[model samples]
Target chain A: MKYISEYRDRQVIDRLAGQIASFRDTKAVFMEVCGTHTMSIHRFDIPSLLPAGLRLLSGPGCPVCVTPVGYMDHAIALARQGKHIIATFGDLVRVPGSTSTLEKARAEGADVRTVYSITEALELARTHPGRKVIFLAIGFETTAPATAAGVLQAQKEQLRNFCILSAHKVMPPALEMLASEGVKIDGYLCPGHVSVITGEEIYRFIPRKYGVGCVIAGFEPADILLAILLLLKQVTDGKPRVENAYKRAVRKEGNPKAREMMESVFRPVDTEWRGLGMVKKSGLVLREEFASMDAAGQIRVMVEPPVEPQGCICGQILKGIAAPSDCPLFGKMCHPGNPVGACMVSSEGTCQNAFKFQSDG
Target chain B: MDELIMMAHGSGGKKMHELIRNLFVKYFRNPFLESGGDAAVVPPEPGHIAFTTDSYVVDPLFFPGGDIGKLAVSGTINDLAVSGAAPRYISAGFIIEEGFPVKDLESVVRSMAGTAKQAGVQIVAGDTKVVNKGKCDRLFVNTSGVGIISEKHTHIATADHVKAGDQVIISGYVGDHGMAVLSQREGFPVKTGLKSDCTPLNDLIGKVLERFDHVHFMRDPTRGGVATALCELAEGRQFGVLIKEPAIPVREEVMGLSEMFGFDPLYVPCEGRVLIVADQSVSQGILHTLHGHPDGENAAVIGEITTGNWGKVVLETIAGGRRIIHMLTGEQLPRIC
Candidate 1:
């Protein structure tokens, strides 16, 4: 609790809140590009504490929310075959596919288990040698290294029953795509955990090309508030540069060993996002050496074209263009219990966060 | 007997009789059970009858601070207690696996008897059944209790009685019971020295009801913790709830585990805590009285009911911000009770 309790000190938070209130003059729109940040901002109700001139928007950072419906459909299809055990993180279990969700498939007796890390999936394969284990690998850079390490370990151990359906995505291309689309984002609070792996250097393009201020932030209340204050300072000084507010964890040069492991196992590929369409080279695929451990290449399953839920504005919400309340089916049709969209399915999804924290608004 | 429970232990023969007379009856020796009759025939008391039943299928059969037996009895007692009833008699039924250890069963039964004695309740009648090894877990307990709701406390502790100005008071720290079970199941590497806050709260609740008539609603925040309980209270009601984040009591260790796992302590389960809703004027008095009891020593006034944002519960965060608190949708696995 040493690192956690100190950051949540009410006295420090109040002082920072006062500083943010006084520092802001002109209206500004800032976007937090991590699902964890979105969750923390809503969980702590940071938006209501900020001055009215500042607006915080949630970007496409939730890996579970942005995972395309086709990925879930394929995973569910494989699970329905009863020939494979589908393992995933807890965040992706309830997200709906084209027709059914992994949770529904699980109720129908599919062998779906929620593993904390991909290494657990490998352990499942090791324990149950007869059953085929397919990990639904979905996450950003912070999680990709672990998945890569699992694959490398599987290869070293020669685990034939273990494979992964890689839906791993990178952050830089998506940020570039957001800027190219002129989405009206004035500043950005970059993801802290992702920066720990990719490093602060990956976000240099945001300021050099798009002229938008970027500040890498941690998940704590003080960290986020400090990131906001830094972005405000950059904007007020007419300086567009990337700053690291989460210096305790993140560095300009990220963990080289993790990057090297991930690079050896995965290669960049074009993949589709749930809300945002395909961005070139934004996804990770198994390298040729580890292609045998790829579930997508091994499994021969035909999935139907995904049909978006009627009137769900999750796509717009993920891009920070529309709020969760903007959708007509928000509370009535799309709720966390029976989510109609990916945004309402994942706990870190923008709509889910809004539904949980900003429903009264 | 056999050292372990066999199929013959549930065959209604000499083995079954010995298992009951020696193992169960030896521990549960109340006069009502000593009657040896098929049913517990009790005379009617001058009050409304409150009947509640619960089945405990908790994994591990035992946990840090309590076991399945303790949970079964305390769970039933808490249900009746929160309904303004004075729990008196409970009937226990057991569904046990065929090869379960006799020693473990005795420990569980002894725990049930001990909890009943502490809560001043009687275990009157009971039944036992055995299934094949794979058909059931080691043991499962089902308990149904009958309590008397005196005229003074009748209908007072209902959610419908919650008005706009009612204050929400939690008995003590939240999330201890949940974190204790999770740490055991998930094998969290960090040692927090946390134990399950599972205990009988009927005495504490009865004391509060006896002294305060302004109490409107009472609920045990068992499975879904305080957030779910408050949301349930707001549902279908014409009022909203606003809770202060800093006001809610959570232990530092519990908070640490919660943060490490990216979980909100507000939604963590608590087996031993009771959430009370009372008029604003009597809130401090109720808090003072609760502090006198061991179970309610850490009690705090955490929130209040409001007319705005009807059917919703919002949290005023420690950062001087506000957000809505919603009910949990998915299964928070490794369930404690």
Candidate 2:
């Protein structure tokens, strides 16, 4: 807890909050594009510390929140086929599909298991050779390299029963799409863990092209307050640049080995996002050489066309255009226990975070 | 006797009688159990009686600090202790899997006897049975406890008695039992040097009930940790609870593992911790008293009840932020997504 506990020092956080409070002059909207950042911001109640003019928006950062309904439907369909053992991260198990969730599928006797990492899924395949182990690979750059490594490890060990259903996404393309769509933004708080893998250089485009300040931030109260101060200073000075506020962990060049492994195993492909619909080259797919390890290509299962739940504005919520309370079904027909949208399902979802922390007016 | 438990041991024949007399009675020797009757007959106390039962089916029958036997005994005792009752007697039932090593059974029975003695309670009555190998885990224990609650303490420590301005005091650290079990079961690579906090709290609670007149609510943060206990105390109530994140004590090792696993320590389980709500006037006195005991050395006043955010639990974070702490819905599984 050395590095973690120090960043949570109350004295440092108060000083940084004061700095941020002093610099506020005009209405500015900043977005944090990582699920962990969004969760940490809400977990620490950072909004209450900010001045009145600055507004922080949660962007399409949660991989589970942004994953389209069809992909989950397909995964659920494969799980229901009774031939595959579906291994997935815990958050995805609760995310609702068009008709069913992985939790419901599991309760209905599907062979679904939750694993902490993709390597555990590969290990499951090694032990349970009689059944096919299909890993529901999902996340942004922070987790993609691990999945890629899992695939390479599986191939090296020649594990025939191991495969992955890739729903991996990249952050830069989604940010570009957010900027191109004229979403109001003055700066960006880039994801710390993702930047650690892809390097801070990947986020320089936002500062250069859109003239928006981008600060890669760590997931601590002081770290976030410092990042906000940096962004506000850039706005006040009429200058925009890529700044690193999480220098303790993230590096300028990122982890070269992880990037190399990710690039070697997967390729960028145009994929659909839940709210931002069909962002070009925003997702990663398994390479053709590793096609046999792709669960989508290896399994032949028919799934119905994905259908959105009626009156669920998760799309708008993920895009940061709508608040969770703005939805008609929020806290009425939809809740964490019986969620109708992805935003109400995962713990990192904006709606879930808002519902848990925000006061009801 | 066979080296391991067999089907004949459950047949209520000569083998069953000898096993009971040799193993059960040998360790759990007491005047009440010596009667060798189907029921324990004791004089009624001059107060209300508290009765509770629990079953333990924990995997890896043995854990870092305690096993299923100790867990079953301490768990039942803690339930009664937190209710402002002094536990007196307990009945144990054991279901042994066939082919289980007799040595392990003896060890479990010894652990149960040791825990019950430490709690100042007697295993007055008992039953034993054997099942097929796969029908049950290696061993399972079911315990029912009986305690005596005085007239004054009968209704003083219920959640309904809680009101605004009451202070919430948590005894010791949280998440030790949960992380210990998870690490042992999953073989986590992280070396946490952590052990389960699974001791009986009857003595600790007894000292407080004897000296305190302002106790409002008392609960052990067992399965869902402090967060769930606070939520239960606030649910459908007229008051809300606000806690300080920095005020809650969590071991550095547990904190490190929680961070690595994407888990919140508040939602993890703790077997030997209690959350006590008392009047704010005596909160400091209660903290001082709790800190004097070994089990409550790390105790602190974590939060207070308020009229705002009724029926909810909010945490004032270390950095001057606030968020609602909800009851855990499902398992606190790791998040890689």
Candidate 3:
């Protein structure tokens, strides 16, 4: 609370709001890459405090929202097999994969489980020596290290039953994908949790290569407001710099040990994103040295890269070009209770975020 | 051994003491447990004390907004705080499964320490019991609290004091704590990056209690969210309550998560936040004070207690349509605190 509470002061917000008001040139779009920032801005009515010219958009920082249809199809394949338990992070449990969710699979009597960490799945393999335990390793860099660590542990333990659905994604490639797609992102509010692991330098590539001003921001209202102010100044000055606005938690290089653990066990590969097509070096896979931990690659499961659902605009929503309301079935046809798209299934999904908060614009 | 919780662990046998010493007494060892008693006796406290006891067995011991430990402490303290009491003391009881991981138990206990430390309450007493894994879902924590109600403050517990013109103000966002717990517990991918807003609301209450004379009623919206809390205040009386959906501070994450899981935040649980119905004159003063506090930073004016559907909660939407804010039929996500 000490580190977090002081940063959310109201007096500072008042000062920052005035600063934001004075800085507006034209109605500009500032895209926050983290789902937390998106919610924080909406939670405290931070947008109302800002000048009407400052338009904030949510980008694809949500891992669950970006996970391709193919990955969910793969999970569905394993779940339908009923031979192994498909263990995954709690966040991935409700995401509507190509045909069904892990929860639906479980309801249909598939051996699906929700785990807090990859290690919980690893322990399951240890406990149930006979049954195959395939951990669904889906996340960005912040969570990839934990899955990689779990893989390393599995190989060391010689757990034959333990394997991983390696769908871990990286940030930079996706940012490149977003920028080159021409989404009109004036600036970026980078992810706090991922920056803690990848450091501030990972984002430097974005501004240097694509010319988008980026700010590594915290999740509080003040933090986001400060990041927006910094971005506005950068945009106004025609500067493209990756600034570390979350210095309290993030460092220049990030967590070295976490990087090393991921590097040692996993290698970057081309992986498909939900909205964006496959990008090279965007996903982490268990190295050849740790092939035994690779379930899909090892078992040689030919899971065709599944197609995105017919009407789901999750891809467009993820690109910040479209809101959840853009879809014909925002609340009418695709409510959270009965999701129609991947974006509608996850809380971090832009559509769901918009739907829940009712921010139609 | 894993099927049923055998009585040997609770029979005061070697296994019983081992279960106590190794597990229960291990995480919860305090002056009370160290005192060795059937029920620990209270020492002493200041004048006109307020004590409230609550047993939380909400399934999914861990939820999006909080776990049983956070709920246990916050729930107990909120009960006292709404009754015009300043929380000072607390006691906890954990009903754990036999094979419940010691580490998980420790994490919940550590969370309790965090909540207690923030609330300025001491864990004066506690007890632990281990049922079989099949008998219980990991853990369930029951907590009781004690607080000192200042003599100068009028009791704001009952709704009979709430007038037709009283203004209803809410601290922070609605359905945040509930959506967080539901999304996390159900593992819905709408990862809102929103953690449970579980904290002590005593600070906000202190600010309001210290200010004006017209502070009428207060309650922490927990299970069934603001709708149920409002309905409780509306029972028997014929006061109409109209709230604007746009006016309420609902986080996009809660909405997103609720949309993803088909949950209604109006029926979701809130932990660190509170709902206050006060005189129109004092509403601004209370909001200002709450905004100053860490826990109540997101406070907003949601609606008011008016005089038509006295028992029902009505929500006015952005489109000028009205919908009844009703009590929860079923938990959007079970086992969430």
Q: What lDDT score belongs to each candidate, Candidate 1 first?
A: 0.89, 0.89, 0.76
Measured over the true interface residues after superposition, the C-alpha RMSD of each candidate is: 2.4, 2.8, 9.9
Predicted candidate 3 versus true structure: per-residue lDDT over B120-185, tens digit per residue: 777767666777667877678888888887665545765557778889999888877766665554
lDDT (10s digit) by residue, model 1, range B1-337? 5778898888989999998899788988878788899999887899999999999888767889988999899999998998889999999999989999999999999999999999999999999998889899889999999999987677555676789989999999999988887777652456667888888899999889888888888999987789999999998779999999989999998888877677888888888889999999899999999999999999999999999989989888877787788887766645578
User: How high is the DockQ of candidate 3?
Assistant: 0.05
On a 0 to 1 TM-score scale, where does candidate 3 land against the true structure? 0.64
lDDT at A183, model 1: 98
Q: Is the docking of candidate 3 incorrect, acceptable, medium or high quality?
A: incorrect
lDDT over C-alpha atoms for residue A297 of model 3: 72
lDDT of 2 by residue, A95-170 (tens): 8888898888989989999888887898899999999999999999999999999999999999999999999999
Question: Residue A129: error of model 2 in Å?
Answer: 2.6
Query: Which residue pairs collide in model 1, if any?
Result: none
DockQ numbers for every candidate?
0.60, 0.55, 0.05
- The regions of model 3 sitting more than 4 angstroms off are A300-307, A359-361, B1-164, B168-222, B227-333
Candidate 2 chain B: worst 10 consecutive residues by lDDT? Answer: B328-337
